[model samples]
Target chain A: MTVSVDEIGNLFARREGTQRDAAPVLIGSHLDTQPEGGRFDGVYGVLAALELVRALNDADIATGKPIEIVSWTNEEGARFTPAMLGSAVFTGVTSLEEALAKQDAQGITLADALAQSGYRGTRAVRFQAVDSYFEAHIEQGPVLEANGTTIGVVTGGQAIRWLDVTVTGVAAHAGTTPMPYRKDAYFAAAQMALELEKIAERRAPRALVTIGQASIANASRNTIAGKVAFTVDLRHHDDNEVDAMERDLRAAFASAAKTRGVEVSIETYWRSPATPFAPSCVALVAQAVDALGYSNERIVSGAGHDAIHLARYCPTAMVFIPCVDGLSHNEAEDALPEDVTRGANVLLNAVLARAGVAATLNAK
Target chain B: MTVSVDEIGNLFARREGTQRDAAPVLIGSHLDTQPEGGRFDGVYGVLAALELVRALNDADIATGKPIEIVSWTNEEGARFTPAMLGSAVFTGVTSLEEALAKQDAQGITLADALAQSGYRGTRAVRFQAVDSYFEAHIEQGPVLEANGTTIGVVTGGQAIRWLDVTVTGVAAHAGTTPMPYRKDAYFAAAQMALELEKIAERRAPRALVTIGQASIANASRNTIAGKVAFTVDLRHHDDNEVDAMERDLRAAFASAAKTRGVEVSIETYWRSPATPFAPSCVALVAQAVDALGYSNERIVSGAGHDAIHLARYCPTAMVFIPCVDGLSHNEAEDALPEDVTRGANVLLNAVLARAGVAATLNAK
Candidate 1:
């Protein structure tokens, strides 16, 4: 096994295959997590990948294709704008120069950060042929645990749309302004938020909506809110459904503004289309779960992962184990030890299935 | 005319009475205004009082009781808190020591500010006997403008209550959390805001409710809101009604939180009871408006004023004129020239009716 770090700061641990010329099977996830994130989020995936390699070594297994465990950089984007910088660059989805130029809040470029952290390497930051990629991560959601499942065979990543909404009214004295005359912006925004929830509910199990960031401009306890700005996050497994949800969101916000006699503007600031994992890779994960006799379900990744970028260039899929309360990007994020081990086992078998075992020795 | 400033920085201009020892009729308002306030709000009242003295001098009229035009310090609390500090101290509602100790955002005490501005005086800050108190100012509301009335005989300052409300829930991934499982704090807060508006509407025309300040804790565009804090401002003419409104507010908020599976807490941070003006003073202003034959209506001062404190110890009334769109405490606040003149005329006659004219000479 040899360890190396790519120029884009992706850490790779490679185990040579018996048939060295064959393309390697990659198994890993990101290492970076949010500032306030729980330890299990991105770390779980990376550690699980490392554990898979250790388990294979203990079994004295050799494969036809080499296996590389990778830990991608800046997956959380907590300190930068674009996330999954390492994977995006590795897959040619984002150029190395572009990723390196991305700056954090303090204006420190990714290149500067990599150099300062002693992680920048001379290895090329571009994609090469790979047999397949498998990632093991804590299922940062309640679906698996609520269903009493141990393994999630992730088929794809969900479609996501981000919106910036502004509601404008007129500021006046809270005491002086009568109800009939007020065009309160916060009130309009509140109504719009509820409407967004209703829209998501209509689409049920698959649709998700969040009004996460909100603020009243020039807020004062004795003055009416004149302007309010908020962020809306909408997600669905299907691109078409997400698009429809966006339409519903805009229409509902417009109606709410009209009813309140305020002006509303909706801007779709970002969009990430649903990423469908390679059928063969997904099948491998499903087969592994079934062969292991673990309680399992087919699911879509609700949050973005390094595999989303990898899926565009190579066959890729993910294995998920439930975290406590479906919480992530929070300090309280937790996963059961048994479930974590089960997820790593799934990843090991899935990678072995894709990489085709060439020889096996007696267990150490 | 003699000009002097009190230790509390209240500016006073005295017009000697024919009978030297009679208690003076005091007429004026504050000179302080909000940071973003219009030129008219506090300045209008002070200038109107000065205008009354000029008009009386133009007609060479002498009253039995001396008249004093006063401009109170820090009436807006835009610089120092506990608004109407000068009058509060004068009326003994607040001590001079307390007023001086109040500080601005920069930690500069009111005493320091007065000293720096060379306005603080050796004269005592406490109030003395007076025939009556009269103030003329912009209506700071839409009522007079909406009704096309020229004069507003202010009956009293409105009852005011401020509440801080917090809603708590669990934070989860926006994309992963199902609608049924999300106890979204922002959604619950939004519902509570709408409910507050509904509650106020049930009490109609006189009742006013505002969710002036609101914020979600640890807000993220893609994370379910875990907690939300907001301020509610409730006002009415009757103190009992305002108290009832508070009860309705608490019940509604609790219900909304319960419906959303969140926890809610409401705290009444501040309360200022209704200060009804003396009926005799109110009638004097009404009589003056009628004698001038300008369209008039009896209205309550929706916003606080120096007169509220004075009403507690002396006969106090405020004369109001329409400001454009009922706007004040904003750069765009405006009032018509004719309305300003009309308001001052009402002030003049109201003061004359309260302090009897002892002598009159032919108009130069």
Candidate 2:
């Protein structure tokens, strides 16, 4: 029950090592869940990290570096917003003040919720130079299971760019206005979305585009929309490709609007560059899997993880086990017990290699 | 204050003529206004009709048929489900019970609103074969004014069709789903709207199309939409042209969905067939305008009028004066004073001819 919370509500349980002066090796995922969330999506990673520490104690193995198991707050961002808030704050990607000031659907600020939940701690989030970082998670997609593989040595994460688009047109009576005289905002928005999709397909196997959300302001069944706003999400394996895709998207929207005599504006809301994990950290994970003789495949993560933030400051890698149907973030998400054990074993050995074994344990 | 309300809330003010046994010549328009309505749209028609009857009495001219002025309920449908509720019910276009049961935004029934306003009456709506019907109104468009004409003999009303469209696709993480694997609903909906515009342009100067309302269900700024629903408003001067346009629209939507690997459904929500006023009624009004030496032109009404319902069971026609900038359903609607007087004079002479001036005004 000894849990220490950081200012942004991240929790950590520390396991002391023999070398008290050394920076700890961090191992964690997130603890928050989606609304219709699975039981093992995030819980498995935290539990496995704790189990790894227990196994070391049982075997009387001593490490030179401390091991700290972390549970990042609001990783799902389902209740609040901007998922991975705790990791983003701890890694300095976002300020702690901004993270705490974020509000939920009920108009309650993150700081307020943390205080109400009694998880707001006096400790500030200060990043000490870490030995290494590792995250174990269920493969949220069907890549691993479909391949008949048990473990995934995650290589990197996809880059993402979010664009907010606003289209403005003249609002008139839908029945009375002739088509030639209308500058319809919804029509322009539709064209923008279709063009984005085509651009993605033209660069297929690499670029991905999605018109995630769109809306006409004060929409009614009988009134022509005057203003429409939507969001475009573009992802690719390379940062330069994403930038090119975004430029194409912007030009397409401008062209559509100009042809229709409407107005359009595009702005970037978020951008996350592609992240390739440290080669040494990745090799250590791969060596552990090979030693354990577990079937494995090299894979790239499509979904964002706390490891992305940690990668900004230290050596970081991830391990993934197969999930039933490759579905995470859903209530029906499931993972096999044996696969879970294998992923934990990979995590245990990878953590050990980075947090070196003490001479006492080596002698034994 | 001496008005009488029917079961469906239509208000009637009857003036006794010399002959009590003959059918009355009905003359009026709606009294309700649009949410952002003009000062003289429906009010001008009702007030002008009342003034016509008062002039007949002041001139000491008797008529064989009585004159009844009406103010139709919910004519704007701004506070109800359907417009022209009163006239539609009175002329048997819609059932009295159905019109009475229509609800407003707050879930308040038309019956309740009528009751709350103390206008719900016990008087039963009885239709008697009328001698003739005449409606005087401001032309809510620029045709007559733009051409330097003062009066418009409204010969007919345009047919209208409303189609509800729904698009279905797979919802997924906007950031994770690949372009080839995703069936985004908004994209399909956008393509449908653009295709409809093309279809409308192909049948230009005859058929009109407008996408009035659209919505994406479970919309999120970062999640691909699974379902999108919108309404299409189609209009034309001929029923056959409108029918052809609708078929083309449906085919285009189905094709868009198929090509995009999504599902689409189009349903009709409302329809109003084109109405051509009785030739005899139109001619009598034309002759009166000619005799009065008013500059006039025959025009088709772009918007719905109460006379459209009256034309179903009786000889009916409309007289229109120009509105400033051809704008109605707006707060800036304006009409010239002389145009109003001229329209009233046309109404006076037209009513005189249909009701048969009892040999008194005819001799004078």
Candidate 3:
């Protein structure tokens, strides 16, 4: 997941005793790392499954149900964006061509990256054949380690709302116009942004409001700003807070417009209600962790993942292991091989428990 | 000063005489209005000078400096920025060629407009030969008119500074990257822009801050703003206020940057300090008003004008007229012909008070 988002070169390692069967349970984390990120996040998830395959092979016994381990591409969005690039496409939230055509900052398209990285495949969305999907990852946050838990059985991820604010102002000769004589736009926008922080502060803890993007029109050092636009990303576990905050934020903006003499337009660009882990998937994941003799404390996932997108189509679950000092998607991302093995052990047994799933050894 | 900024038409009038002494004391304002606009601004100023010329002619004062009235081109800079086009060129702030070469929003150059207008002038900067420059304009504010004053003597005009803020952020897909997971540039910029009002507010009652231009990289409704840039115009009559606001604003920006993982760059494109009117010119103006038995008040010109530039070389003064409701630069801008006549009277007297200004003799 570096500069180029194409050609995700991912390899699958199946247990020697594993066999391909209908309705296989798919399990593995993305193989890519966050740019300048933690090593164990996506990589550890895949490695854990591979370790499961290796350990299972040693047992010399093939379960009736088959399981497959595969690593998806562009999970961290380091080189490519819309993170979880593979899963979003797999679930049909995004089209393959669209995903492949997505461009990076350098103007390199995902299709071009695929050709460059040699990871392009004709295979259909993985969810089409899988009975269930499971991802093992390192918890990017310190919640797991702080609680002294060996693993985190994520209950679900939080809901997110992305807002884009575009404020329009007449472009004027800055030097010729005086302060009180002219209508200034950036002033109103800036005030609103600060007010949003105050709103966030009031909402505190649950309502996380971030002013991520700010922009201006015909922006020159010498001209009065003709337009001002920005982005507000607000996440909340509760939908009402999201709704309320949106209203409050909008009201604040409207008032600002009346006072500042500039026109403002806002659009809700994206919205995703928080999706909790399905109870069945949560229970199965817990059972697998218990079978492996590891502690399973639940925590909320602060970040989005492919599982969230896949939730739209099939039941999905995520397993998190501790990366070194709870760091992921960083250059310092590291984890012990044993921890990777332990997480994979749980993943292996969990996949095996699912009915109608099979171990796969398909010839390419 | 329409779209064809270069061609404002021919400049001429009855000199009343043909000799050097017949050249009237030139008095008038620009014909152009700001593009987005306000009325009774430039247009009224010119009408005031013309009304004064008519009154002088009607009175049959053939020996007095024969008054000439004019309407300069591209004053408000609606089509072409850097307002006061004709005046600036005359003052040598920039060359006529440069002004003519300036481009409009449609990317058409001023040279193109000049060709269309057929108004290319052969005259060079005539600061030495020209008589006193007097302009009558609206108060544009409630300062004097509210006090029931009929005339205002401008002591000086405030300085102005224009800036462009360019923020570099990593553009990523808004959907795939969790709000927390992505380094959204627009968000950070939002914080910067939103805080602008607070920046100005902290200095309260004096500091002026505006963000007029805002833009983003890969500006899609569903994309995390990666690269954002905007313009900020900070203006103040008090240099300390401008300095202090800038320092504090930059610090707040740094704080936001530290909190949000984004890079920001601010480039100062324009800076001009406040210019004070000449005491001698101011005295001459006050005399004109006092001699006419008109109400008088000394005030700061709320806007920049040709008088500001001309003041550097020769004596420049501004007379005041009221816009019905103190509105200028709007489509509804209005000023009565009587007010225009009053302003002209002040301008004519001020010019005549200066010795050696030979208009009738020059004409003969």
Clashes of 2: 0
Could you tell me the TM-score of candidate 2?
A: 0.91
TM-score of chain A of each: 0.96, 0.92, 0.81
**Best model number under TM-score:** 1
- Chain B TM-score per candidate, please: 0.97, 0.92, 0.80
The residue-by-residue lDDT of candidate 1 on B299-351, one tens digit each, is 99989989998999899999999999898888999999999989988999999
* Displacement of the residue A92 alpha carbon in candidate 1, Å: 2.5
Clashes of each: 0, 0, 62
lDDT by residue (tens digit), candidate 3, A64-180 = 545567677787777787778787777677777788788999999988877776767555554465566787887775556666677788778778888888877655545444456
Model 1 ranges with Cα > 4 A deviation: A361-364, B361-364
Cα lDDT tens digits for candidate 3, B1-364: 1111223332534344324464345567777775555667776667666666565556544434444555666776778988777767766687766777889999998777766767765544444355556778876655555667778888777666666777776654333344444566666776886677677667655566766556675465445567877777787777667777777778877777778877777777777677777787778889988999988788766567777776765566788776655555557666666666677778777866743333442232
Error of model 2, residue B166, in angstroms = 2.0
Query: Against the true structure, whose lDDT is highest?
Result: 1
- Report the TM-score for the A-chain of model 3: 0.81
| TM-scores of the models, in the order given | 0.98, 0.91, 0.70
* TM-score of the second chain in candidate 1: 0.97
